[model samples]
Every structure is written in C-alpha cells, then in structure tokens.
Target: MAAVTDAAGNPWFSWDYVQSNASALLAALIQHVELTAASVLIAAVLAIPLGILAYRVSWLTGPILALSSVLYTIPSLGLFAVLAPFLGLYASTVVIGLVLYALLVIVRNTLTGLNQVPVEIRDAARGMGYGKLGLLTRIELPLSLPSIMTGLRIATVSTVAMVTVGSVVGGYGGFGELILEGFRNNFYKAQIMTATIATVLLALVFDLVLALLGRLATPWSRRRAS
Candidate 1:
C-alpha cells in the first residue's frame, strides 16, 4: 500500500488513489446500495403486514413487538456471526441481520401511523359503507404514508451504516471492505476517507430520494406542509 500520506509525509487526500481505485470503489458502493435496498425492501414487506396484523389483533401486538425487539437487540457482529454459519458468509447473512434490525422501526412506525387514524375518519368511512379492508386500504394507508416513509428513511440510513459489519463475514461488506482493507494496510487514510465519504453520501442520497417519493405519494401532506 502506498503511504496514505504523500511523499512529504503529510496525510492528504489522493486524487491518484481515487483515479487508480475507481473501479473497486464503485463496486463497493454498488454492493452497499444493493444490500441496503434489499434489506429495507424485504423488511418493509414483512413489517408492514406484521404491523397491520398487530393493529388488527391486540393480542398479537406484544409477541410481535417483543420478537422484533429481541432480534434487534442482538449485536450486529454477533448476529452476523451466528447467521454466517447457516447462511455461509454470503450476502444473505448480512441481509438477514439488517432486515431484523429494521423491523423494529418499520413495524412500530407502521402501527403508530395506522393507530393514529382519527376515529371520526373511520366512522365517516363506515357510514359510507366501507368495510375494514376498505377503510385500511383507502383511508388508513394513505394517511400513514408519511410515517411509513419516515421509517423507511431511518431504516435505510441505519442499514447503510451497519452493512460495514458484514466485512467480517466476507466481501458482503461493500465499502466496509475498503475500510477494513485500508486498516489492514497500515491505516490507509485515502482509502478509509474515501469509503467513509461514499458511505455518508450514499445514506444522504437515499434519504433524499425516499423523501421525494414520500412527498409525491402524499400530495395532501405536501400541500399542507407548504
């Protein structure tokens, strides 16, 4: 590894390093994004439904929340280590951990959103002859878009940060690989800084994109906000 510092021995950002390692960096970033997106998407699919189930059945709420909380309390590295045995250090090991970690946020937010729907709104919907399904799909979901999307943005950022732990498992770590490799090579400043910057930027970009989508999905909220 080249001195992260230039010939003068001062720590410096190296354009040459970026130029030389562009492909590897790009690959790391892409993997990071893919893993984050996949984990969040899967978590949402599971959590949203579980959240609804919890909402509909008060008796189910305690177990569902407790289970997700327990899964989340397991440390990331420990979770990854336990899963790697069964999943074989593949992306799946890391992804499953991420999904589990994400469930708490998504599920809680989803349930909160649905639960917050005004009683008057439900009564009005019922007066119009809307059934439970119709009320949920038509009234509750649309009103809950903001909360659900907020949970998504939070989960996405958190997942991007945690994905680094996957490095211990293998190439599944994305930019984490860069950070780990840089550390292994005597604290390669350029490599580490580059990876750190890319990771932060990725999280910001995802949050922005999700915010835009949420805004578009809830035009009523947008108008009210304005």
Candidate 2:
C-alpha cells in the first residue's frame, strides 16, 4: 500500500484508498439514493392528488397553488430549523424540508398535465359513457403522461441535489456527507472528488432515466431506429 500525506500532515486521499474503501463508498451512495428517492416519492404522492383536485375545482387553483408557492419561498435550512425541534435533528427533518421545496414543481406540473388533456377528447369520452374515473384513468392520464414524466424528472433531479442538505442533520451518507466531511476537515481533494462524482453521476443518471421515460410515455414522439 502507498502512503500519502497532506499539507497539514493528515492522511490524504488517493485512488488506492478509494478503491480499498469501495464497499463503504458504495454503501453510502446507496443510502443517499434511498433517502432521496423516499423523499421525492412521498412528496409526489401528496402533490399529485392536490394538483388534480385543484384543477378540478377551478376556484381552488389560485389559493392552493399560492399556498404551495409560499411554502417554496421558505429557505430549506430555515424550514429545517423550524421543524427540527418537533421532528428532532434527523433525516425526517431534512426529508420534510426537501419535500416542501419540491411541492411547487410537482404540483404545478401535475396541474399542467391534467389541464392539457384536450376538452374535446374528454367530452367524447363522456359521450361514450365513460365515468369521471374512467375518463381520468383511461383517457386523461395517458394523454398527460409526458408532462407528468417531465415533472417527475425535474423533481428527481432537484431532490438528488438537495439531499446534501440532509448531511447537516446526520440524515444519510453519500457524496454530500463525503464533501461535508472533507471541507470541515480541510481535505480539498476529498471535497472535490466527492462533489464532482455525486453531481455528475446524479445529473447523468436522472437525465438518462428521464429520457427513457419520455420515450415510454410518448411512443408517438419516438424516432425509428435506423
């Protein structure tokens, strides 16, 4: 094994060190994904329904969306600070705060998706004796899938980046925790490597997933393979 020393006489990171500790690094990355996915899914489950209801009622959209917007205006750290006393300094506080930040994007996209369902198509579905639920499930949802997928893509990317905020509360370990530890301990390469890998990997994976989803949701939009 090779030994490397830093400017402060502390042990510095090297490729060999990262390779030797691959298992722990992998575990941290998985934990980070779990935390980010859980938070986004919870928020989506809540926001999607709220958006649908807001669209259906016509009168509720203004006030309800405004309220969601107001929530978005609150700083993540400030929100976490307020929630920590009740939730305790834990992953839950960070999850709650991140979810709140995601609400506007999810809800607005949901509303846009639902509204984009053509009125003519909806009326025709109704004329064919489709019930409200049938129209929504069979007609509206499928047609609006592209928009909804767009929302999910946006939310997932945002949430992945924001999960770093979790490290402040001992939420989960991953690249963010690595970066935080590095900076706090003045390990510049650790900070740079972790931050770079996390950011690049997050963006790449999410963008690829979103592209695949877009194709699945809109078959008509897909181009023929040469």
On TM-score, the leading prediction is: 1
Cα-based lDDT at residue 202, candidate 2: 76
**lDDT (Cα) of model 1:** 0.91
91-129 per-residue lDDT for model 1 (tens digits)? 888888899999999999999999999999999999999
lDDT of 2 by residue, 15-83 (tens): 665777677677767877777787888888998888888888999999879989999898766776688
Candidate 2's C-alpha lDDT? 0.77
List CA RMSD, all candidates.
2.4, 3.5
In model 2, where do residues sit more than 4 Å from their true spots? 1-14, 171-173, 220-226
TM-score of 2: 0.85
